[model samples]
Each structure stands twice: as C-alpha cells, then as structure tokens.
Target chain A: MSFLGGVDTSNGVVLDPECSLIGESVRGRILCFPFGIGSTVGSYAMYQLKLNKVAPRAIINRSAEAIVATGAIMSEIPMVDNVDTSLIKSGDRVVVDAANGTVEIRDVTERHVVTSILRNRGRVLILKRSDKVGSYRGSWAGVSGFVEKDEGDEEAARREIVEETRFTNARLSRRVPARGFRHNDSVWTVHPFLFDVSSRDVSIDWEHEAYAWILPGELKDYTTVPGLGAVMNDLLSRTSP
Target chain B: MHLTKDEEHVLAGEEGAARQKAMELLVSLGDIYGAERLIPVKSAQVSGASFKTIGDAGIQWLEDMSEGTRASVPSMVNPLGLDMRRWRSMGVSPDFHGKQARIVAAYRSMGLLPVYSCTPYLAGYRPRRGQHLAWAESSATVFANSYIGARTNREGGPSALASAIIGKSPEYGLHLDENRLPKVEVNLPSVPEGLVPLAGYTAGKVAGNRIPLISGQAFAEDEHKSFGAAMAATGAVSMYVSKGTVGHVRSRGIDRSMIEERVTISSRDLRRCAEELSGDDEWDLVAIGCPHSSTRELAHMARKLKNRRPRRNCDVWFCTSRMVHSRCPQHIATLRRFGKVLCDTCMVVAPIEEMYARTATNSGKAMVYLPTLGRQTASFRTTDQLLEAISR
Candidate 1:
C-alpha cells in the first residue's frame, strides 16, 4: 500500500488574497492548492492572470475548486490533482504533471509521482497518500492513483474514480491521455476525466476526515489540503458540467 | 489584407509621422484581429493621453504606432487632464508632457474628440452590444457586454483608438458570439436590500470571468449596475446577470414608479443610498463615481453641502471626464468645500487602496466591486447606503 502525505482538514482552507499576484508572477509552471478561497473576484484575478499571460502552465492540488476550475478552463491553464500535500511546502520544488495526473515531489534529492485531482461541488475531497507504498502517505489528497499492472489506463482511471468518489457509475466523459508533460525528475502521464455530480450527490470516504461543497470562489477557506485547491482550479478549468 | 487607396498611400509612407504611425498601428492591429481591411470609426477613446499611470515610452510607442492614419474619423476620448498645468501638480514630468502633446496633436489631426472620461456611455456614446466600437473604458466594457449585450475586449488604449479610427476591432475573445455563453449558474439567497454591497460584491467575485446566468432571490434590476461595477473593478473581467426591467440598476427591484420618484432631484435618494451603506469595517478605500459622476451629480453634492460643514478623515472624491472637468472649473470651489473632485479619472484606472484602507461604492454593477479594485471584503451598497456609511 502506498500513501503520499497528509494535509490538515481540521479547518477549511483560507486562501491568500495575494494568490492572484502569486499566480500571475509564475510565468511558465507552478503548483498550488487546487481551489481559491471564497471571493468570486478571485476568479477574475485568475482570468486576469491569464489575460496578462502570467499564469502557471499547470497546477497540483489535493482537491479541485469550481471557481478556480472555471478560471483555469477560461484561461486554458493545464492542471492535475491528488498530491501528498503534507510533504510539500509553499516554495517546494514540485512538478505537477497534469498530463499524467501525477505530482513529482523533488526536494533536494528524492523524487516520486503521486496521482490526484482536486474536486469541489458539495465538499472538497482530501485523501491520505501511503508514503511507505510509493509517494504520498498520511498526506491528504483529492483523487489519486496509479495504473494497475494489467488494467488499461482508462480502466485504471475508472477504478481510481470509484476508490475516490465511491461511485461505481461516475459515467466518465472523455478520457484525455497525457495532456501535459513530465516533471523535473520523474516520468508520469495523466488521464483527465470529468465525472458528473452535483453538490448534493457526493459522500465522504474514510480516507478523508470530512467533505463539504465549498462555495466556488471561497476554496481558500480550507487550509489543510492546499494541494486540493490547485487540483480543483485545474479540473474546474478543464471540466464543464 | 485588402487596403484602400488612402490606406495604401498611408502604408506607402505618404503620411507624416503621426499619420503613418497611425496607419501602421492600425494595419498591425488589424492583422492581429484578422480584420480584412480598415473600416471607418464612429468614435474612438485614447488611453495614456495624459500619462496617468504608464510611462513616456508607452506614450511614444503609441505615437510611433499611430503615425500615418491621421485622416481618421471623429471620435471620443478619455482625458489626459484639463491642461498641461494639472500635469505638474499631479507630479507628471516634461518627458510625459512631450508624449502627451504628441498624442494630443495626432488626435487633433485625426479630429478625435477628447471628452476624456471612461463613462462615454454616460456622455451620450452608448455602443449597443455587438456594435463595432473603439471604447477604452474597462468598466464600460463590462457594462456594455454584461448589461447591454455589447462585445469588446479591454485590449488596451492603442487598440481602442485603432478600432475607432478604422471603425473595427479584432473579432476574438469576448467579441465572438459563441464565447459569451454563461459558464456558471448562480442562485442567490435573496435580492440584496438597499446598501447590501455584498450582494453585488458576491456576484462579481463569483463570476468575474465567465458568463454567469444567475437567478437570485434578492437580485433586482436596480442592483445590477453595482454588481457590474464590482465585477469590472475586481478583475479585468465582465459578467452577464439579469435585471427584471431596466437591465441594470443602482438599487434593488426599483420599479418605474421609484425612478419617477427619483426623477425630481431632491438629493433624498442620494442621502438614502448613503444612509443604507453606513457601517464600520476595515476598509481599503472609499471610491466614488462608478461612471464618472455627471456634473449634475456634482452639483447635487454642492447643493447638499450648502448648509453643512465638510467632514474630515474621509478621502471623498468625485470622478468625471476631462471635458466636464474643463467645463466646470468654477464648480471646483463649490465641490472643494465638500470634497475633492478628480477630473479625467475614475477608480478603474487609479489605485484604490493607495489612498484608503478599504473601498465602498454605490453602483450595482459587479465590475467595480470585484477583486482588482479591492479584496472581496470591500463593502458595497446603493448611493444611499454609501451616504449612510460615511455619515455614521
């Protein structure tokens, strides 16, 4: 069993007001919480970041936020979900390979790929990755996993969805393969999938302490799983309900 | 791709620096927008005409780019300021003066009208949604697209002029019909009561960039203008929310009767709006003039204070076009008795937090309430609400 890292879900994530400035400062690629905090104007800041051509290429989060997701979509920034957030800090050398839904955490030396996507509607999702197994463990994540030895990428993707969302019939839309690229020291691929669900349909799994459909712009209220914000931002951008 | 005889002549350098640069700029801009040829402008608005925030280099670049197309049509403008005199008072330099003069000279040659206010729509230059126009107001873009269904991109000053002189803009981004569709669905708890700035503030923060098709319990047409203003102010974004009748409003569900009630200017509504907005919070700044308040609005302010003394600690400002500023220098003494009246300026281009700690506004438009102006914590309300907040 492989687990990545852990994130604090005791209180909701509180987003930084200057997050937009941070997002705009990164010229090429950056990793952050999937969703932004509650402020619809934050959505505009994201778009402005894109309009000014100053947004990151991709993002990594433990959960995905709808507002950030919408911004990423409108701005056309690539993103991925499900990373071991406890293991990463604000300025850590982490690579979000949105092409493979895996985050390559490279701090000084050791590097590994963790798969996940930040999602929001009813509540943000956070999962604990198993560090002993692979990359993340005891770390809170959104949705994450790796391909099974025999299962195809799409089948593995579906299985991961079931494991994360607890919905056997997620009704996967289109499965896009490797929508991004490899990170600093790892080779991984991502399969972007859109699952149809509303704020009322989601239920929590033990892997996460709690779940609630956070308002779109206020994803920053939750602080534990910062990675979830980045993932939510990316998925929201790519997936349209 | 297809240049007119005059355009060809300008392209061939028959025009002087102002004319040549104008033509070259237009052609380059046209190529970017995929415009087949230059079209005539109904009007245009210039940015950095007085070098408010940008550098002299930006002004010089505009001059160099707009070289040859001086034979352009009549147009409107956003102000550089009343005269070069205000420039030094505002800490503007001589280099800035040279660039501005060059632009002013070019605009004079092209016969561009220098009204110098962002609220051209307020000054009788409303471009119906989807109409090809060269407007330069960012809030105006949000107002036109979200409230009026017009299409434009807050591309920049030069592009706006080019579009006006050529009477065409690049047909991409918001200009495309298909792109205007709402991406998010918002359902509000209730239409905000008078001075509930958060209602419009929430809407703007929630749907800054996307086309938001919202049906809120509290949303009334009167508040739409505040929402639109907030949306435009927060970010470089626009919105599309519905108002029952007027399309946009300064209050909640203000019916025709209320407008009739307000038609006779008693300054009562203004006082009411201000009262409703009175409250204490850690504010970033207090912003006035969502569309650059009209002279009549300023006159009302003067009239209101005819009997009262000026209040201290509050940095109140009245924004207006350059033309309006020039037309009423005498009015300045009256207004100064109450507060500062900044001409050829709006909060849209000027810094909000730079002057105050938080912001408050009375417009129902989202463009002004959104993040680029102040954080989500910024307060909002009707003009009446603002008055209340300030008085308390």
Candidate 2:
C-alpha cells in the first residue's frame, strides 16, 4: 500500500480505493493480514497511526516482510507472523507474543489427525469420503482418521491405514512430521505416512465410498482435501531417488 | 539466531531501552531470514529521511529514538523533502520545513552525518571493496554492492538505523560470499547514448531477484550510477555483476556454470521500452537527477546549456548533492539560469504532488516513482530531449 495515498494516518482508515479494507479502520484492534505491500514509506505511516493513538494494538501475518516488520518495530506495536491467518475470524480475540514469535486465538482448539498414503506400483491411493464421515464429506483424501487421546502419531497412522483400507500387508516406507491446517475453530495437525503395499486391492469401509490409485502429479485434477497434494508430494519426493 | 554473550545481554535489556529495542529489531530480522549471527558493519546509509515521505509520525519516532541511542558507526541519510538552508525559497511551506528540521535535529543528536544526498558514496562516505554496510537507499545499496564491490543487503530504514546504532547487521543475503554469485546472464549489444538507464531498467525486469552478470559492455562511473539506480528501482535485486574491464585488465569472476537463465537485450528492445514509457509533452515541471547529479553530470549539463537560453515556460529543477553543488559553482550558476539548482532534495522524496500534476524527467528511476510518489503524470525523455525542451 502506498501509505501516503492509501492510508489516512489521522483516522487510521485505509484510503486506497483498491484496498479490500478501504472503508475499515485499523484502530485499537489486533489486525490480521497476509502481509504488507507497497513502498517503504508505509513504515512511517504506521508510526503516524501510533502517534495519533489509532494504531492496531497487535498485528498478525501469515509471513512478515520487511516493510510491515520495520513499521511494527518502529511503532512498538506487537507483531507475530507465520500464523495461519484463515483460522482467525474478524472478531476473534488474539494474543500476540512478538518475542516468541507466536500467536494464539483464544477460543480455537487444535485437533491432530493422521493422513497415510498407501502406495502400490508407483501409484498412491486416494480415498473418497462418504457422507457418513464427520468432516470433509464427499471429498477425496488419503487414509485419514483422528488420533486417539493416548496413541502416538505413528501408531495412529498405522491404525488408520488398517482400519480404513483393510490392508494387512502394508509396509511403512517413510513418515513425515505433522503439518497444520485451519478448518474453522480447530487446527488440523496432519501426520502423513507413506506405506508400500504388496497388493493394489483394498476393501473399503463405510467411511469411504470408493478409492483410486493415482500418480502424484494427477492429484491436482481432483478436488481433494486441503494440503493433500503437499502431503503426497513431500512423501513421494523424499522416497524417490 | 545465535547471539554472542554481549548480544544476548543487549537482547535481555541489560543495555539501555534504546539499544535493547535496536537489538530486538536486528534479532527478529535475523530470525526471520535464518541468520546464524550478526557481523560488524563499516558504515550505514539510511533512507526514509524526507518529512514528505515519513510525515509527522516519523518525526515523533525519531525524536523519541534520539533521547538515548546514538549511531555507533558513521551513517549518512537519504535526501530530505526540502533543502535545509534554502527551503523557503524552494517553495516549501513553513510547516514541512519545521517538521524536516526536527527530523534533521533528531538524526544530528544520534550522530548521523548531515549529508542528505542519495549519493552517499560521492559525499565522502565511500565504502571500500568487500566492506559490509547496512544501506537503505536502493540506488546507493546497488552501487555499493555492484560498483564499489562492497557488501550489504538492501535494508529498510528502521533496520539500517538499527545497524547504525549497533554497528552490526545480521549476516545474510548480500553479506555472504556464497550469495553474491550471479544467477542470470544478460548479454547487451552496446548500450546507445542516453539509453543506459533504460537498458538497466530492462535488465532489472529480466533479472528479477537474481543477480545478473552483464556482458558485452563496459560502463563509465556516471553511466554505472544511472544504470544501477534504475535497475534497483525496477527490480528487487541489490546488485549486478558486469563482465570485462577492471583497472589495468579484464577482471575474472563470471561463472558460466552458475547462470540459470540467459537473456539478451538489443537496442530495439530499449527503443521499445522508451516508446512505452514516453508520455505526453505538456509538463508543469521538468526535474532531473533521480539519484542526485554527480559533479561530472553537473559540468556536462552546464556545458550543454551554456549556449542556450531558458524558455521559462515551466518550472525546472536541477537536483544534486550539496557536495557536488559546492564543487561546481560555475556549473551551478549556469544551470540555475535554466532551473532551481536544488540541493539535499529530489523529485521522488519532495512533495511535488502538492505543486505539480504533470512532470518530465530524464531518469528511469523517476519514471517509476513520479506517478506514485510525486503524483504526477510522468513523461520519460532523454537528457538532450529534456534540455532542449527546457532551453531555446
């Protein structure tokens, strides 16, 4: 944002007609955005907002770039980045720990899940969830299920693969660390595992309607769950030469 | 980020609040960029100095920062919104002049040099080859890294100030030798006269974030200045390596194996760029020197305008550093007949939007900034074209 033209420093209102928050005021609240764009002069504009006592108390970003980071530091406003900003709502009460580089949404709970990719003959299995499943119904996913309260991530991954696919001869090839995604009030921490199965045949449970074996690149054509492509690519690339 | 014991102490606020804040900024930036440690810097050149750019909020912040902190290394500032001594005569309002004075006073208390030109290297703070500096001005940063062979990441104002106060910057980006290698190869077939800046502009668009190794041409010092300034403005890169000619022989360091992409810009391409950038002829102001004019540029302009008479149809400005202006009294006198010989200010940083709507310039950097920062309908012309329009 060209701070000189885009922002009204006196009122804390974004003035740029092209800006999404054109009519919104960034005053006395925790402002969450992807990142700042435009000139370096935006730093001084942020300071001007602080001098007017209309600056945001804190700022949360998906990733912090230089311009906004400099502005936040100079203005002494608390800022934290590398946050999944989609989890945060308009009225969500957020706490920013700038020193630790962490942000917490007060009312949100984190849920851990295990999504295991079963590979047979260089093709990964894609399972389409039935309407009976709790979330992501009628969506394509890997062999996925919630992690039980006492189970380890690997144990959860193995258990889910067996329960969902009914494959007993599956041998684990690789296991990646957990990755997180925001779905409403819960952040789904997905633990992905790659398993090489001796057979392509699978018996589907009531949770899934059908299953298909697809190459990693073909995963893009289907409407799969969020971060499914990333999970498959990570596991496949690591296991490849 | 790995901090030394002293740095950790500063981070822990064992030092004063000002140092603690500066340290915090450096550490946070270091963490963001995955820097392992901080390295000492030789000097710093900071931007965001103009009151027109920073506004009242910047004035307050600087005034507050000046209370306890001081620059540990020699630091020079970018151009201000008005000339320090002759602001009133330059048509700057008293309100802006007052705010600018407060900013100047704040930086003065913090031990920053009052050389408010963008050409800090030309203003007696030239960094030697391989010296690490935390420079904010895009033009100067590119010049320092690519021309002078110094080391620096293109820093923001607050971060550069932080480095100035601490005399250290996070070791990352351009500071590391491994990161300095050129990734793209730009082959230029002889840049024509009055087209070097446009060539640089095109080269910047081709290079993007990667450093481009330019081949097939060797440029003079002033030519390199304009070229690098335009390149930095048009691209995110801080440096470009030109092949051929250094000192008594051809300098080596172009690794062909390292180049990922190769691009060639011809004279026809530069002409197309000029055609695309060319705007209408009617202008309210014709401002020169985006990266302030050097002494040689001043003398060259003076020689061109010595036989011509000013038309006085529109207001014109010849912006240059105070050092260059002082060195060329005769040139300054000759140039002043055509326009105001402004020192310590340029079109980009000054509040030209309040005064003029349509502007013309010979700088590629000004072409990029005039429409946005200056709020002027910009027309790009060659130096001869602009001089002809202003004179006769």
Candidate 3:
C-alpha cells in the first residue's frame, strides 16, 4: 500500500486500484498488507492521516520497506512485519505487538503437523488419506500426523514416518522450512521432512486407504493436501551434505 | 547489525522518543540491507522539502518531528516549492506560499540549514573523499559517490532525516567498497556537442540498476553534474565510475571481470533521445536547472543571453540555488531580463502543472520526471538551443 496517490488521507480511504482493500477505510483499524510502493512522500501522507484522526490503529506487513516503516514510525502507529499477510483476512480481529514483533489473530487456531516424504530410487511415496481422517479427507499426502506437544518436530516426523508407513530403516535426509496453510479457522503449520529408504516395501496404516510410488514430477497431477507439492519440490531440490 | 551501547540505548528507547524513533528507522534499514554496523556520517542532504511534493502530510510530519527533535548533525534540505521572497512574482499563490513557509519553518526549527537546493555540494558543505554521508537527493548522491568519492546510498527522505538526527547511516550498498565496482561498462565513445545529458540518459537506460564504468570521454565538472543527474533520473543507479574522474577510487583496483556487461552509447542514440524527448515545439514554459544551476552555469547562460533580446514567445525560468544566485549578481541581473531567475526551486519539484501544461527544458532528468510528476508535455532542448529560442 502507498499513501501518496495510493490512499486518501482526509477520509482514510484506500484509492489505489492495485490494493485489495480499495474503497475500504483504514481509519482506527488495523491495516495488513504485503508492503508499500510509490513515492517517499507517501510517508508524510500517512502522517496526514494521523493528524486527520483517520490513521490505521496498527499496521502489519509481510515485509517492511522504508516507505511504510517510516510512515508507521512517524504516525506513531504500532507496526509489526515479517508476517504471513495472506493468512489475515479483512475484518479479522488482529492484535499487533510491534515491540515484540508478534501478531495474534483472534479466533484463529493453529495446528502443527508433520509430513515426511520417503524416497526409494528417486520414486517418492504419496498416500491417499482415508475418509476416516478428520481433515482433507481423500486428499493425497505423504506420511503425516499431528506433532505432539512433548515431541520435537524432527522426532515427530520420524515417528509419523514409522507409524504411518511402517518403515523403520528410513534414514533422515533433509528438512525444509515449515509453511502455514489457512483452512477455515485453523492455520496448519506443516513441517516437511525427507527420508531415504532401502526398500519400497511399506505397509499401509489406518489413516490412509491407498498408497502409490510415483515420480516427483507426477505429484502435481494428484489432488494433494495444501502446499504438499511445494514442500515436496523443496525437499527434493537439495541433497543432504 | 552491531550497535554500540549508546546506539542500543537509543534503540531501546532509553533516549527520548524522537531519537529512539530515528534510531529505530536507522537500525531497521541497517537490518534490511544487512549492514554490520552503523557508521558516523559527515552530513546529510535530505529531499522531500518541496510543498508541491510533500503537501500537508509532509508539513504535519515535519512539525511533529520538530517538536521533539533537532538535527544532530549538519543537515541541509532540498528545494522548496517556491522562492520565499519572490513567490508572488513567480505567480505562486498566497495559499501555496503559506504551506511552503510552514514546511521551511518546520525544517528550520529542526536545526536544518535552509539551503533549499539539491546542489548542496556546490553550495558548500561538500563531503570529502572517503567520507560517509546520507543524502536523499539522487543527483547529489551520484555526484558525491562518483565525483567526490564520498560513500553513500541513495537514501529516501525520512531515512536521510533519521541519519541527520542520529549522525549515522547504515553501512551498505554504495557505502561499501565492493558494491561501488561497476557491474556494467558504459562507453560513450563519441558524444556530440551539447549532448552530455542525453549521453548520460542513454547510458542510464543501458546500465539499468548496475553501476556503469563511464569511459571513452573525459567530462568537465559542470558536464559531470548534468550527466550524473540525468543518469540517476533515468536509471535506478545513483553512482557511476567515470573512467578517470573517480579520483582516489581508481586506486581500488577495479577488476575487469566485474564488468559483466559492456554497452556502447552511440552519438546517434543520444540524438534519438533528444529527438524523441523534444516532443512538441509549442511549450507553455521553458525551464532549466534540474540539479540546480551551479555558479558557472548561471554565468555561462548569462553570457549567452547578455548580447541578445528577449523573444517573449513563452515563459522562461533559470532555476538555481539561492547560494548560486547570490554569488553572481550581474549574471542574475542579465538572466532576469530574459526570464525569471527562480531560486530555492526547480521545475521538477515545483507545482508547474497548475499553470503550465506543456514545458521545455535542457535537463535530461527533467525529461524523465516532468511528464509524469509535473503533468507536463515535456520537451527537451540543448542549453544553447533554449537560450537562443528564448532570446534573439
């Protein structure tokens, strides 16, 4: 978001055609966006909004650029960035801890789940989640399960691999950065791990009805769980040193 | 980013909120750019001074900042939207001057020098070779980094202000020696007479964001000024390494392997740039001085127009800094006969769209900005050509 020519300072209304919140007012509400663009004078336009008593109560950005950060500081508005702005919906009750650099979205629950890919001779294992599963039933995924509060993420990943696929000899290869996916009121933070196995002999568990060993390129053809394809590519792109 | 105990205290808000805020901005920028630590700066030249650019929002922000803080270092400001003394004569309205006055006052109260020109290097307070600075004016930043061997990234208005209050800037980008090495080589093998700005203009287009090693021709000081100004305007780059003009920087052993891209700007290309940017012959105003005229430029223009008579075909403004204006009284007087010798402002930052729809200038930088920012159908001309067009 930009303030100069991108927003109306007098009424606290967004005028930028490129913005998602066009025609909506930023007054007295928390503003969440990816980042700012346009002139440096946009910084002062933000201050103008503050003087008009119509500035955002707080601001959140996926990444803070100089323009918005300067404006936020000058307006004395609380700001926190380095956030997943896509998870935040308009009208969502959001709390920003600018000092601590944390954001809390009210009514949004978070779930931590681990998913592991078992590779044998370059072919990867993808399981079809059974209807009995609570979420994303019938979606294709890797050996996955919830991460227990007492368990470390990697420990949970190894445990899920053994229990769900019945593979004990799979050696841990690599782990990619965790990603969050929003569904309903829940934010599923998925931890992805890759493991190398000696055999393609894995027994199916109760959580999945079917399993298939397919090329990494074919993962996109199947209806998979959210961000599974992305995590799979990330996991497979690098070899463990 | 590594901060000293006092810097940490400022960031932690142990200092006043204003200083803390300034520190926060500096530290945040430092973190963003991956600076190891903050480095003390010699001075700061801040942009976003013009009321036509900043408007009411800028005024209020400066006022708010002024109440709690003052410049910790020697800081100079960019141009205002109007000349304080001659606004009415320049056809500026009372309402515009009133707002412009507030902006000047806000900056003044914050202990900023009311230099009100982009050419702070020319108006004194020139940064020495190897000295660090935080300057917001793109043209001056280029001049400082390339011509003077001063280290600085092209800072934004608020960032430069933060540096002014903190007396420090985050060491990154052009502030570092490695980043100053030219990635692209721009060879202006042969430039035509009166086409230095266009040479820079074409070179900027070819160079893009990379630093260009400008070679194949030597440039005078004033020639370098207009060249660097146009380059910074058309390109994302703020610094250029002119072959021989880099002074002490030539000793840094610039690796030939670093020049990954080599582009030769032909004399034909510069002529094309001029022809294209020239647009329509009819113009509402003919304005000069984008980086603000140096004393030499004012004297040269005065000499050319001294023997001629005003054509009175259209309005003409020879824009320069008050410092430069004060230095050459006879030149100012002679130029004033042909047109207004506007001080403290240039065509790029002024509210020219309100009174003029079509404009003509000798500045290649103005050709880049006037169409979009000033809302004018901009035309390009050589300084001699413009002088001849305005006077007989």
Alpha-carbon local distance difference test for all models: 0.51, 0.87, 0.88
Q: What DockQ does each prediction reach against the true complex?
A: 0.04, 0.71, 0.60
Ranking of predictions according to lDDT? 3, 2, 1
Candidate 1's TM-score on the B chain:
0.66
Please give the range of 10 consecutive residues that has the lowest summed lDDT in model 1 chain B: B257-266
Candidate 3 deviant stretches above 4 angstroms: A120-123, A127-132, A159-168, A198-222, A238-241, B1-17, B247-252
Model 3 Cα lDDT, one tens digit per residue, A10-102 = 999999998989999999999999988877888888988998999999999998888888888888899898999988888788988988999
Name the candidate that leads on lDDT.
3
Task: Report clash pairs, candidate 3.
Answer: none
lDDT of 2: 0.87
- The C-alpha TM-scores of every prediction are 0.49, 0.93, 0.91
What interface RMSD does candidate 3 have?
Answer: 1.2
| C-alpha lDDT (0 to 100) for residue B145 of candidate 1 | 66
**lDDT (Cα, tens digit) per residue for candidate 1, span B29-116:** 5554455765544556655454434334344444454554552545676655333445454334566566667767766655677566
Judge the docking of candidate 2 as incorrect, acceptable, medium or high: medium
On TM-score, the stronger of 1 and 2 is: 2
lDDT of 3 by residue, B144-196 (tens): 99888899889989899889999999999988877877888888888888899
